[model samples]
Each structure stands twice: as C-alpha cells, then as structure tokens.
Target chain A: MSATTNHPMVRFEGVTKRYGALTVLDDLNLEVGRGEKVAIIGPSGSGKTTVLRMLMTLERIDGGVIWVDGEPMTHMQKNGQMVPAEPKHLRRVRSKIGMVFQHFNLFPHMTALANCTEAPMTVLGLPRREAEERAAELLNMVGLGDKKGHYPAQLSGGQQQRVAIARALAMRPKIMLFDEVTSALDPELCGEVLQVIRKLGSEHDLTMLMVTHQMGFAKEFADRVCFFYQGKICEQGEPKELFTAPKNERTQQFLRAVLEAV
Target chain B: MGMFSLSAMLVAALIAIAIMSLFGDNALFMSGLLQGAWLTVQITLLGSLLAVIMATTAALFRLYGAPPLRWLAVTYVEFFRGTSALVQLFWLFFVLPLFGISMDPFSVGVLGLGLNIGAYGAEVVRGAVQGVHRGQWEATTALNMTRWQALKRIILPQAFVAMIPPWGNLFIELLKSTALVSLITMSDLTFRAKTINDTTMQTIPIFTLALLTYLVMSLTITIGMRWLERASLRGMVRGRGR
Candidate 1:
C-alpha cells in the first residue's frame, strides 16, 4: 500500500467551485494527514460546508483536483491524460469516504439496522449476516443498539442522528465527513449526537472533516480548526489558538458574532 | 352510520328493481348485460396492469434516463394528455389496420385504454418521485449506491407510497374509459346496453343499469385502494410514535 501512513488521507489542490457568477469555493488548497481531525467553522455562505460536500462528491468542483489516499478522486489519469472520473471510478473512490448530513437523511422505509447495513451489503458485497453483524456493532458503538428495529420516523432527532453515524461507520470508510450534523437537532439533543462523534474522534484511526457551529465541541474534539471567509481559508490553527486567539479580522468578527448569539 | 348507509342503499336498490321489473324481461336483460360486464372487467384488469407498467417505465425514463429517452417519455406523456382518449382508441382500432398491423378488437381496446391512461399516470408517477426529499437522494449517494440501486431501493419505495392515491384515481378513469371500447364492437356493458335498448326501446332502464354497474365497480376500486394506502402508511405511523 506504499506506506499508507506517510500519505495524507485527503488533499485538495487549488479546488474551485462556482455557481453562476458566484464562486462558492475559490482555489482552495487543504490537506489532512491520516487519522487527523479537522473542523471547519465560519459564517454561513463562507463555503465551510462546501469543503465537506465537494470531498463527498455531492457537489462537483469547477477547477482543481481532490486526492484521497494519494489517488486522484475528482479526475482519473487515463493514458497520461487527466480526465473527469467516470461513474465507476467515482463510485470506487467515494466508497472510501462516508458522510453524515445535517438532516440525518436515514431511509424512512428501513429500520435503523437496515439503513446501517444497506451500504455494506449493497456496495461492498458483504453477505447479509456479516453486514448485519457489522451494523449492529456500529449501532452499539453509537449507543443506538436498542433502536435498531426502529425506523427513522420512529426515532427522536438525537437517536436518528446516532443511527446516521452508525450507518456511515458501517461502510468502514477511511475518511468521514460531517456537514452540520447536529444543526437540525434541538439544542438539548445536540449533545448526544456530538458525544458519538467525540467518541469516534478519540477511538478511531479515521480522517474526519466536520463543518460545525458547535464552538465548544469543535474546540474540545477537533485537532485542528479552519476558519473560512468568502470561499477561502482565512485562518487555521490548533483549535485552542483558533477559537481563543483568532488573528484574522474576519475570523475575529465571525467568532464574536457567534459567541454573542449563544 | 355504516349500517344505516348500507340499509338505505339496499332499499333504494330494491325499489329500483321493482320498477325495472314492470318494463322489460329482466332475465334477458341481465344475461346479456352480465356478459358485457364480464368483458368490461376483463379489459379493466388487464388494461390497468399494462397502464401501471407503461407509466412506471415512462416516469423512470423522464426522471433519470438519457436525453433521448427523456424526450421520448415527455413526447408520449404530452401527446396522449393533449388528445382525447376516443381519438386515440379510434386511431388504434381503425387506422393501424391500413399499415397491415392489425390487432383484434380486444387488443385494441386494452391497448387504447392502457396507453391513453398510462400517459396521464406517468405524470402522477413523475410528480411523486420528484416530491421525494432531496436529502433521501443525498443519503443514497453517500452510501455509494449506484443510481439504479438508489432508485430501486430508496427513492422508488417512498415515491410508490405517494403514488397510490393518484394511481387509484387513474385506474378508475381507465375503468370508466373502457366503456368507450363498445364503439369498436367489443360488446362491453355499454355496448350490450345499447343492444338491449335498440330492440326493446327500454333506454331508461338499460342505461340506468349500466350506470349502476359502473358505480359499483368504481366504489370497489376506491375502497380497495384506500385499504392499500392505509396498509402502506402503517409503518410510518408507528415510526412517528417516537
């Protein structure tokens, strides 16, 4: 595997994403080392969430390439020429990454266990018994073992978010992305969801990218923090330094506004 | 309330039978009409099956297929929805024979009704599928599901529940439209009614019986579909309890 430990788990090189005349992401260059925990924080519309979205392949990049595990993800090198990755290539690359959304987007028709097991059985070609076993373990890890038979609609917002985490973990992804995962939950329920993520951060050797508004959780859990402004990473440092002694004027103002609101 | 309605309907039906008995040979009328009704039932059951197949295929094409396939689906839905069902039926029954592609009257009736309603039903299916939340699509993609697998497992099942009421409506419309097939000599209920009226000149009683038969069939379909909707919704209701 070419000494996988030496390679960055994810690298974004001069990535750009635009919508019409508005540039959502502008020549972004970022890298996360293996097993690193990175948190993205910024004002809304500053492209904090876009960073995770582009990595998940949910949004297309207008320019530049993203590399995962030292392999080009957004483009494939074909015959010495870089071309947009084919669907097959995209699927293969994306399988290494898992994402949990703000809405907890669990399949309503499926029970929590089924939702957790679906990707393992369908995409990875794991047998049903093995997939179920893996899903159960992940569910238990997320503290949702008792809710496995419950459908998304039956679970509370916190429970559903936990199931979503387990579902993503069941895929055995090398990298995990969280896009405002606790944003939709009530303030009282947000802690339960954050706890699961905190546990993952401490226990797993997985690269994690999170876009979050929970300043306290980000400070406590993230190894490094990036503050984006106007589609660029305006400031980044250790979470303690970034949160407490932010140097950039924009990051200072953004943090002040957020802290005042809370 | 249910018992009252049932008894009221029974009394009204008995009184209507008493009046009809005074006019014509009820036995002969029923025998001829029953045969026609049987044929109508056959057409409806088969045509509805065909319509569901066509509608789902066209809807999937319109939503996810390549540009050319989407164009074809849109063309079909627009053309059929724009025109009258009668013209489409006549075109199938009378026009296609000239091309040496002849179909029996029964096949024409089923195809004519099925295709016409299928076009309308396609819109219902498309709307339901589109109404599914965007988050569901994102979740499937995040799970690394292929487009086909996503539709088959995640998107379509949720959409299918939304489609039931509308499909029920379309099926009833298809059932009623089957009466039009009588024009091409398929001898459905309407056709048999006309045959009875032609000889006996009992227009009021014959047409009335035909109308009542249609009402009964429509009622059955409505009730059956409502049961299906409730069954499908049971899991959702249970889930909401949390």
Candidate 2:
C-alpha cells in the first residue's frame, strides 16, 4: 500500500445519503486500499454516482462519516468526540481528494493552462512560476502541451476531458474520483480520455474510484469491481471473479442488461 | 437585439446632437440645459458606483450569507424592487428627516436612486451567478477552494461577462430615473427644462433639448457597455484569445 499512515486511503463507515424522500446510499460501508483502482458499476438510479459524489464532498451525506487517510472528512475529532467539521477542517481534509466530472467542467473563461494553475496558486498559495511549471507539466502529461493556450470552448469534448483530468491532477490529490468522465464524449473521443486514464493508472500510486458504464474497462483495469443495487453493494470482489461468476441475481441481471445495451 | 441595432442608435444620437447645435442660437438656453446635464452626469457616475457595490454585496448575501444577513439582504431587495423608485426618492428626501436621517438633496438623489437601481441589479447579478454551470461550482469544491476564492477567481469573472448587457440596461434606467431627482428639488436636466420653459414659455425648444439630451446620454451608456462587453469577452472564449 502507498498509504502514508497505517489506515486505508478511504473508509466509509455506515455512510447514508438521502435526497428529500429518497435514500440514495443506505448504510454503505466500504474501504479503498491506497493505490487500489476501484470501479463502481450499476444501472441508473442505483446510486453508483452518489458514492463518488459523496467522496468528493460535492453532495453532503445525510448520515454517517467518511474517512480519508484515517481522518473523518465531514467531522473532526474534538478531544475525545467527533463533531461536524468547520470550514477550515473540512477544507484541509477535502484537499486530499479531487474529481473529474462527466460534463468536463472546465472554467470556460480561462485558458487550459489557467484552469490547471488557478487552484494551485490561489488555494495552495504556490507562486506563479511554480504553479505554471506544474500546470504545464500536467498539461503535457495529458497530451495537451501544445493546446495550453486554448480555452475550453476551443477544444473538442475529448480534449476538454483531458484538460479536466489534468486540472484535477494538478491539485496533487492522493485520491482521484472519476464521475463518468467519458459519458459525454463521442465514441472516437472516448478512446483518448480512456487512454489518459489508463496511463494515469499505470503511472501514479493513487487510489482511484471511478463510476463508469464501461464494463470492458472496469473488468480489465480495476483491482476490484463493485456492483451497486438499490443503494447497496449487491456484489463486490476481484474483477475477474465478479465478472465471471457473480453470485447475486440482481448483479447478473444488471450485467446482462448492460451487455445487451452494447 | 435585432430591433436594437447599436450603430443605428449612435446615428440617432448624432442627429440629436445636430438638432441641439442647430438651435445653439439660444446660447443661454443651451448653457442652462448643459449645466443641468452635467449634474445629471455626476449623479449617474456616483450613484452607479454605489449601485454596483450594493448589488454585488446583496446578491452574495442572498445566495451565501448567514441566516440573519440573508434576511437583511432579502428584505432590502424586496423593499426597493417591490416599491416605486419615485416613492423611494420621496421617502429619502421628504420623509427621512422625520426619522433623524436628514440629508442634502444631492445626497438623497444619489443614495435613493443608487439603492433603488441596485435592487434591480441584484437580481441581474444573482441570475448571472446562478447561471454559471453547477459543475463549475463542484469543480471548485473538488479543488478544495475556499468559497471566497471560488467566487473571486473562478465564478465572478465568468458572471461579469454575462452581466454586462443587463447592467447596461440598468444604467440607462438609472440615467432616466435621475429625472425623478428633479421632482425632489435637485436641479437636474429635466428640472432645468421645466424651469426654463415656465420662465420663458419657450416650451418647444426647451423640452425637445431635454428629451434629446437624455437620448444622447442613454445612447452613450449603451455604447460604453458594448465596448466593455467586447473587451471582457476578448480573452474569455474561443476566437477571442488574449
């Protein structure tokens, strides 16, 4: 494990999420070992994306606690007890994670290089020269070194997704979340983004949690595969075991449906 | 936008200026109107500065402030937006003295109209801020940005681009509403027209000049805003690289 501490890179202890009357993630307990690539797959409304969203702190969980690098994300230990984290505490813990979205949410007003450098300079307080150097390096890694001056509007969907990935990686997050990063791309474009993901997986010792519909990639790349159903993990195990001989009927049905859709 | 061609408006302003100069034989009449127009310009400048500040603050408060501060912002926007600008001007000028908040006529004009126009501008600002994609905000969170940092570095610059056109309309509205100050006893352009018309009964020339002056001023605002919009977008999107 690449973990700096004895604890797992991420642990979800009895985490529950709800939206008004809907319970999206129910009493979910999961853990990710450092440097493990976990892929979450399920049908729409099965709460697959919510897992990544909750981890990223985009949507606040209604119940339970999430730990990153052995520390609670939404709550902080106060003397002997836990309380909801203050902004300062939350920001500190949350900085360990980063996310890329399906929509490729690049800041439309900034150049590709600016989008990558802004948070590092402003939030991390890196000087312009260092930030720019780091950003330029990441942009090149994502294969957009020549396009750093291009705005989001000027790039293709695939190029934008790569930039978004670079922007997320620019934060030097220990845990990266991919929330359907290629769902919006053209089929030809999906390959370029997937190639970046593949390269990042091989190159970095970072824990990755990807919510995806790409069964092939999940089966091939993920260290473990989790199939979520009705906000519960119906089946999870080694990707080969789960793909070859899933025990849960719901998992089998979901996999069959997904295969048919292709 | 189709009905509101900018070049056509500029041409109309030129025609109005031509008409004003054609009757420049009435030099005293022209000069009196000119002085009034100058006061209008000053009031518009100061009031607009205040309005922009108030609008941005109230919009931020309404969206992200604490409970009490949010309520204060809500009440402010509703009160000023829901009521008449003229009544607001009157209350600040005529009624505030009863409440131990007396001000000179000029201050009242600037404060009252600044606040009233700011109320409308708050909505514009809010719409533009919220109009930014939800994912942009999520991206900020993913990067672990402080709320203030997200707004200042990421959000507001984007929102500013969207807001310029509506803000231009509000500015022109503010310029037109400067006429209301004249009713409260400030010697603005409209007041000068009414006064010189009453004194000399040169109704045709005086009222026409006043109407033309307002048109020219509003046209100037429109032109300035167009320039600002172009300048801002230059570095923002594709084909307009810095």
Candidate 3:
C-alpha cells in the first residue's frame, strides 16, 4: 500500500496463536512503524504478551506469517511458495529483534559484563575485546558501570533489569520487545526501569513494542496505544486520545478497573 | 580441589591411619589389602569417567536426538539399568570370552560398571538439565543463540551444578558395586579380602579393613562433589558475600 522504505518495522499478517482449542491471538493484524514506540495495554489473557512473544519467535504462530524488517521471520520462500523457515532463515531474521522478559532472566553464572558480551561474541562473532568494550559502554549507559563485574544475583531488581536492557541493546537490534518487564519489580523499582526504557525510546532510533500494565508510563512513553480485548485490538490511537477518551466498551471497563485498583 | 572441605579430608586420613594401625600386627596382610585398595581406586576412577561420558551422551540423545537415536539411547539406559550389575558383569567377562572377544578382567570391570552406572546417571543429567528455569532458555533464544550454543554456553553450565550431588550418589553406588567385579575375578579389594579370609580365616580384620577403605573412597567422592558444586556456584552467587 506504500513505498517499501515506508514499510513498518514489524507486521503481523493474519497471525494466530493457540493453545489447544483456546485461541490466544486470533487472526491478528497489526503494524508498527519504524522508530515508533507502541504500547499494548490489555487485561490479563488478552494476548498482549503473546503478541510480543510471537514477534520474538518464542511462541509458534498457528496460522499467519510474522514479518520483521521486511522479511518473513517464521517462513521462507522456496519454489515461489511460502514454507516454514529453516534454522538459518529463522536465525538471520531473528537477529533484528531482541526481547526483555518480565523476570529479568539474566545469565546467573556470568557477571553483568559477561552477560552482555556473550551474544555479541558468540552470535554476532565480535572479538572479545570489542564485545567487552561495547558491553561496558551499554552497561554504563544503563547506569550499571560500577557493577559490571557483579553477578546478576548480586544486583537489586531494578539494577538487574537495567542490565537486561543493556544486554538486549548490546545486540543492536532494530526492534525491541518488552513483555511486562516492570510487572515483576517493586513499585519503587518500576520507575528506574521505566526511566531506562524512556531514555531508550527518546535517545535511540529503534522501534519498540512493550506490553505494559503501567498505564501512566504507557501514556507518557508511547506514540500510539493499542488497547487489546479478547485477542483483538479494541481501540487504538495517539496515547493522549486513547487514554483520555476511549470508545470501546471493553477498553473503558478495563481502564476503569485498573484505575480503581490503583 | 582447593575448595574441598578440609575436615572431610582430615577425617578420611584419620580413618585410613587408624585402619592401618589396627593392622600393625599383620603388616603383610595390610600391604596386600592396601595394594588391592589401590587397584579398586583406579578402577573406580576410570569407570566413573566412562560413566560420566555415557550419561551425558545418552541424556543428550534422549532429550534432543531424532527418533532412531532417541530409541537407541532409551534402550541403552533401560538395558543397563534394568538388569542386575552382577549379571551384566558376568555377561561381559564370561559370555564375551566364549564369543572370541576376551578382554582383560580390568577392562571388563571398567566397561561393565561404566555402562551400568551411566544408565542411572542419564536420568540425573536429564533432571538437572530440565531443572534449569524455562526463562533461561527464552533468554538464550532472544539473544539469537542456536540450540547447541544455548546448551553448551548456558544450559549445561547451570545444569552441571544441579547434577553434581546426584552424580556423587551414583559414583558411591558405583564404588560399592566394584565389589561385584571381584565375582569376575578382577582382584579388587573384595577379592583380596576373600582370598586372605580363606587362608587366615581373618574375616574380622580383613573384612573390616575392606569396609573402611570403601567408606574412605566414597567419602572422597562426596567431598569432591561438594567442592565442585561450590566452585560452579561461586561465579553465579558469590558476588554477594565477597
């Protein structure tokens, strides 16, 4: 529908994900523009996390193709027909995307610096010296420079999450996915993590898709907000418009419940 | 080795010394048992090494191999673990000789016990690898690591710490089973004790010495395993205390 250069950084074309008979993401179609920050807000079981997970290829798509950086991530072209992707195709397409989990899943056995350097050295095939230098810079960027030699267990929840962000950023991925990253942190700790994310959104040109329950942060940080309800986008628009005046019944009810809880 | 518990080593040393002192009146008998004990130690070490290799290979095969390879691994694990070690040892030492594949008694002992204990160790490896959190695998995937890279660089290292205690138990079980090798006429500690008993009818001192030596050997395994668990855990957890 537009110039190839104007294509979104990510597109979910009729994507479906299911667990047995339960459809989690039902024939979903969503597009995220390059360098845009899109926040997915929904109630529990709305498939918000699954959307991000499918893009990361952590979950299998039951039906449709997921495109990343203008390439099919879950399939490859063979004989002019689409087929399930080979490992080489999957890996090459996947390198453009990185994810941060809610649990701050740092490699426990490695120090912060090593955690960040591991992928750069092994997957990206960067030299150890350069990897360390890049990791050090990213760790410092996340404000954990002094804790580079410390293991993940030694860091606070906020500190570990910042390191996780740095580890992801070290890969230089164009699209970053965050799956309820602040859900596991303390209320005070949430700010530090959100701040780091906000810094990334503002300072870097990367496109980001975050599944967040933090409505305020979502409103402030996101260019567009998609309110998901029962595996579909119920309402979506500029953050201010969607937050201030929502038209969908489910979105209205969900926001009201969240506000009441707070 | 540096991280090994000193008190455990000291206790083992004291037990050996006390057992030796009790044999003061029978120095020749003591030397014979000691020599046999040394052979048992060697057999245990080599057998344990082989068992480790078999366990890791079989577990990986069972977990990640294709259909045929998976079936082969499962068969090996069940066959070794299901049958009696004594029968397996006899089959290897006796049955194979009749088939014109005679091996040295030492080789039979090592092979039989290695294959036997490794079966039990396969489950240990699998359980430990599976015990690692699912999040670790997702993190590795997000980093663009291949399955092999994930297993080698992340999964196995974490699993190694979890597996050591169970491997320690298997090793001790393997050490105890070395006595079964004497049935194949391998001249381990048990064989020497039996021979000495037949001649001197000294079941009291000779059998007692054999039991003490086995205890010492198993204690060494336990201590060594504990040391390994700690050394692996140090880099993961020691950032807090020191």
Candidate that beats the other on lDDT, 2 or 3, i.e. the better one: 2
How close to the true structure is residue B224 of candidate 3, measured as C-alpha lDDT?
77
Stretches of model 3 off by over 4 angstroms after superposition: A1-3, B1-24, B238-242
- Model 2 steric clash pairs: none
* Model 3 C-alpha lDDT per residue in residues B1-242, reported as the tens digit of each score: 34345456658766765756565455668778888888898889999999999999999999999999899999999999899999999998879989899999999999999999999999999998988888899999999999998999988988887888899899999999999888988788999999988998877777877887787787777877888887788757622211
Q: What is the overall TM-score of model 1 with all chains considered together?
A: 0.95
lDDT of all predictions: 0.89, 0.90, 0.89
The lDDT-based order of candidates, best leading, equals 2, 3, 1
Worst 10 residues of 2 chain A by lDDT: A1-10
lDDT of 1 by residue, A18-55 (tens): 99999999999999999999999998999998898899
Best by DockQ: 2
The sequence of per-residue lDDT tens digits that candidate 2 reaches over residues A166-215 is 99999999999999988988888999999999999999998999999989
Predictions ranked by DockQ, top down? Answer: 2, 3, 1
**Candidate 2: segments with Cα more than 4 A from true spot:** A1-4, B1-4, B235-242
**Per-residue lDDT over B1-242 for candidate 1, one digit per residue giving the tens place of the 0 to 100 score:** 24356456645665675566566477569778879999999999999998999899999999989999999999999998999999998998889999998999999999989999999999999998888888888888899999898998888888888899899899999999999999988999999999889998877778887777777677667767877988888766522312
Docking class of 1: medium
